[model samples]
Target chain A: MRAVDTGGYLKGRIRREDIISAAAVVYGEVGYHGASLREIAKRVGMSHAGLLYYFPTKEALLAAVLERRDAEDAEREQLDSPPGLEVLRHYLALASHNVRHPGIVDLYARLAAEAVAPDHPAHEYFKRHYDEARVGVRDSFRVLAESGELRAGVDPEQATITFIALMDGLQVQWLTTPDAVDLVGSLRFYLQALLTVPL
Target chain B: MRAVDTGGYLKGRIRREDIISAAAVVYGEVGYHGASLREIAKRVGMSHAGLLYYFPTKEALLAAVLERRDAEDAEREQLDSPPGLEVLRHYLALASHNVRHPGIVDLYARLAAEAVAPDHPAHEYFKRHYDEARVGVRDSFRVLAESGELRAGVDPEQATITFIALMDGLQVQWLTTPDAVDLVGSLRFYLQALLTVPL
Candidate 1:
């Protein structure tokens, strides 16, 4: 058998990462609809065809970009398997992190909104994304409620929906009027309103 | 002197309203980027040139569509001159109203998110819109705080931002998973958490 080209595979993986990073920036600047694959390729200093070899379609590139974001959040924040209080804290930290990185937040806010249409390329992805997100947060709230850390009379499911919505809504407002909106501060206020223990 | 042509003017006004309504549906379906003037004109059963005579540009039509939505909300909910407690109640009602009218909600969510890009046609429009929205909500919360109706230790400005964000965020979530999300219920939950006075 022919020997595998480990160096070429490694280089290909790195090139894919570069392309995804460039796509995230371009998508933030012009939105997914307004973004051009050619521009993203140009940003990464690759030929359009070369970029397409890595990401065969704009939609595929978008998926990679979004996946990379989720992977980063999971890796950095330990968001994949968080405890109840930690979940709340992580979200607050996330708000702060998003404030520091406006590009991905912009990309997310725009794509989430655009994908609400049933026919959008990312529609199923967003629906599943939100479903999983709600379920995860809801479980944390359930844990908080069971331990009496959550405020009395608060439905964990409803609170989860509200909390997720607040995070998303804050992003749009922050993106729109960053000077006027305080993402982390607002999130903390809501958390304080929800939880019995200090975060 | 030329005749005033009152009947013709009324017909023209009616036609313009029809076009705006149709544009709203199209925008909601495909978003602004995916929608076309020709399609909007076709929906209203008018030639594109005829429609352009009224709106001049796609951007102009988008502005009119957005303005009409705001006008409807203001007139129906009396959101323009809202009292402190009434402001919260009206928003809850607004959420309920939005649930029933998915099309408009879809349009607003998509446009608001897309308009976060500075180069978008609706960018300046949304910036001004959110600024005014925050100011309006903030004033109401201020009035509530002065009357001791707002929860103790709740900052009116912070609450105002959270409240606006909640409304916006709920729309996207609701649009994504209408079967799962309760827009009005979540709004009520937050309002109760914020106010000392019962609705």
Candidate 2:
């Protein structure tokens, strides 16, 4: 019988996470196209070949970075498990959470923009990302509507679209002029206007 | 009196506009960093040197491109001249106008995302651009508030921020999935919710 190298496995996982973190910073600073593997490896004190051993290509590395971001967001917010109004409270909390991590927010903003092109590598990724995002938000709003919690004449689908849009647009303005925006507060204000009950 | 070369001057103006249009297309396709001057020049069927003769540098060309977008928007919407509710109406109209021209909207979205970096070439340009935009929208909302046309408990400054954020955010979603989003309709829905009167 062979013994499992549990310690080594843990080390490898930690090193991989470190690589993803460095890649996020580089991708945030210079975008996906402009980011170089050599630069990302150097940031982590790894050789290009060593980094490739973990992530074979730039696209692979990008996928890891994005996946990690989503995992972290999902775990922290527990956004998927919550239902109806709870989902929205968690979302607002996520905004507050994002304010403290400008690096990830900046990376997301840059990548989402670059992915608008149909041929771009992240295009499909973003398309699916938004789709899942909308569905989750829509389902929650629908629950609210069923209970008569949503205001009169506020369609759940439309409210979902507007809510998502407001989050995205506020990120741009807040990123450009951080002091000028109240990210969480503005979101709360919009929600207050949309819902009949209190948050 | 010496004869004026009016024909030559008109031809120069036409060529300049052609270059700007081509640049917009290229910039919209690839972001500012990824876009090349040679490619833009090639699209216009002009030599690199000839293009430089018109605009001195890449930054200069970018500035011209952004300035031209704003100029055309102001002229078409008369957004700056209107007061109170009319200003919001024109902004909504501008969104409708934008749906017919996805290329420009794509360019603005990409650049706005890229320009989030403090050192980006268009950083200051976007900073001032958003500042002026917020002020224009804010003043109009303030006027509505003063006249009691705004919904109760809605603050003009906060509404201005949310409105701008919604527009910017909706653009990202719309660009990603044009069919899934109702850009102009969403804006109208938000305005309807915020105001005591109809949009």
Candidate 3:
């Protein structure tokens, strides 16, 4: 009986993963607001009911997609224990990577803007996202300050906020005019201005 | 006969302005893709054909709405020929004012993100917007630099890009968490860092 239950749970997890991958593709192609669960299920060769069994609702599916993206990003960056300056460098590398994946970038840009509405399905997710992101980056800056590598008179907390703001802002501009805006270059410039030691 | 023709043109302009105002409200409530010309006309107590007579297509109406917004912003700020650092200061004030008008802010955020697509109706508008904005702001920075007010080694062009990026980025954050994100304060911090003299 125990073995049978374990097999069933494993099968369910695999199915869920497949659904998320398909949803990501659909969401990336069109935006969250533009996509429908039916299209995602069709892409995965499942019925809408089958997809609903896994995600319950469109919002649930969206939340799952966002969570998966975050997990993949963290894993890809090996973000476990990078040093203070390394974290910022990782972001630059990520920006370069983002340029190669316009679909994901568009998905993110669209959803982030849509999620600004107070009643949007992803509203709380984005609010918490910015808050958590700011805290994490701030801690990284604090580490640099403690090690005496940060520039003089620069407040770590303020720098963190400005850094994140600049990154988010640049992403929007780059999305619109990929040829005109240099995402990684602009970021590197700002970092050089902020840090005492070169990145 | 010429005076009558001039009066007719004035009347047509007033009707067009009314339609644009109605479209702005509707677009602000829903988004661009979600809004319809019929609905906008309904709001203004006109038939769909009447609105179309003035603006031709939904895209034309959207363009007019955006143009009206830019005009209002310029007029409100008295943005004709402000001095170097004063432009940045004006942005701070604008951010503060933006808090009071969430509808317009959301409209801009949503449309800006959506317009990132090359085929989007407002694509060209946003592209030209960034180009013009950068030149205008860069000129202001140059004026400051010529007077020895800019910080050493700060490039006017780069500062212009970063400044616009920061403002755009802070707007997204502010729209999501108005109480948490200090839009004006963040801009002030960045400006202080860029200028040789304290703001």
- DockQ scores for all predicted structures: 0.77, 0.78, 0.71
Candidate 2 pairs with clashing backbones: A169-B169
Output the lDDT of residue B92, model 3: 74
Candidate 1 per-residue C-alpha lDDT over A1-199 given as tens digits, one digit per residue, 9 for 90 to 100: 2236887788889999999888877877866777999999999998999888987778778867887787788678777676588877887887788899887787788778877878777788888888878888898999999999998888998899999999999999988888888789899998898888998
DockQ for candidate 3, C-alpha atoms: 0.71
Q: What would the per-residue lDDT of candidate 1 be over residues B7-69, giving only the tens digit for each residue?
A: 788889999999999988887786677789999999999999999999887877887898888
Error of 1 at B129 (Å): 2.0
Assign candidate 2 its CAPRI class.
medium
The digit string of per-residue lDDT tens for model 3 on A1-199 reads: 9999999999999999999998887777777768899999898888999888998778778877887887787678755455598888877877788878877777777778888877777888888888877877887889999888887777787787788888888888888877778888888888777777989
Candidate 3 displacement at residue B24 in angstroms? 3.1
> Candidate 2 residues B56-147, lDDT tens each?
77866786798799889988999897569999999999999999988778778877887887877788888988898899999999999999
Q: How large is the interface RMSD of each prediction?
A: 0.9, 0.8, 1.1
Estimate, for each residue in A1-199, the C-alpha lDDT of model 2 and write its tens digit: 1235887788889999999999988876867768999999999999999999998888768868987888889789988975699999999999999999887787788778877778777788888888888999999989999899998889888998999999888998999999899999999999999999999
The reply for model 3, stretches above 4 Å from the true place, is A1-7, A27-35, A56-60, B1-8, B27-36, B56-60
lDDT of 3 by residue, B1-199 (tens): 9999999999999989999988887887777668999999898899988887887777768877887887788678755466587776777777778878777777777777878888887888888878877877888889989989887777787788888898888888888877767777888888887788877
Best by DockQ: 2
Q: List the residue pairs that clash in candidate 1.
A: none
Estimate the TM-score for candidate 1.
0.85
- Ranking according to TM-score, highest score first: 3, 1, 2
